[model samples]
Target: MAAVSLSVSTVKPLGDRIFIKVSEAEAKTAGGILLPDNAQEKPQVGEVTAVGPGKRSDDGTRQELDVKVGDKVLYSKYAGTEVKLAGEEYILLSEKDILAVVA
Candidate 1:
């Protein structure tokens, strides 16, 4: 079967964690073909496809997540642990590693 990169289903995160699907940029193509690996753009952006529940603090209060699933986000160049889902690459990281949300 052919692979589908994006999914509409929901994936709830566990705690203080999030699941993001890195967005692949369009390859620089001249003859309608993709560019070589060296010519591709560096990955720096992704969409939050899943989010964990709020984490509990020492005070017993739940700290809510700043980001939610479907939110476009920016992360550090070397941040996040890379993961694979449904044959696609994903990133698992804490909210701290995320630099900003793309609005």
Candidate 2:
């Protein structure tokens, strides 16, 4: 038998959470000089690729998620857990960590 691999192009996070792919860091600044890899700040914006089933509140009701898949979101500079899927890097975070959904 041949080895089989499963390609998960999509994932569903659970409970007030979401999955996003971090944007690439800027390679240069307006000063016209290239910045070192470490000099660039970690990107805070990313495109939402997956969403979770809303969380349950104490009231016995589920809180609805605000962001949807394909929405560009801005998150905190120091939030989310880094993970790898299908050989691609991704982040799993709670919706609360998301600062804003890009208009």
Candidate 3:
């Protein structure tokens, strides 16, 4: 089998799915205490990298998504599939999984 190569530019989401670049987990506490790698929680925030066209409507039309590329957003903690490309962590999830735009 031939090996496949994946890159951010080569990926496209179908339906209402979205691709996001995960933010780095905090390495230290607010009190200036250093935390271990395993002690940090998975970040629920990220920047939208790619987005699907839209979800299909009952009349075969496409419903536009509220979020757009480069928007910083917060999502459900357990939602989305984790992926790594070029050593960068990312998540592919449905638009519903996104809780809010971070402003």
Best by TM-score: 3
Worst 10 residues of 2 by lDDT: 3-12
Candidate 3, 1-103: lDDT as tens digits: 9999999999999999999999999999999999999999999999999999999999999999999999999999999999999999999999999999998
The candidate that wins on lDDT is 3
What is the descending TM-score order?
A: 3, 2, 1
Q: Which ten residues in a row have the lowest lDDT in candidate 3?
A: 27-36
lDDT tens digits, residue span 1-103, model 2? 9975634364668899898988888899988889998899888998998888899999989989998889999999889998776776678999889999898
For model 3, which pairs clash? none
Candidate 2 TM-score, true structure as reference: 0.84
| Cα distance off (Å), candidate 1, residue 77 | 1.1
State which candidate, 1 or 3, has the greater lDDT: 3
**Candidate 1 off by > 4 Å:** 1-11, 29-34, 38-41
lDDT of 2 at 62: 93
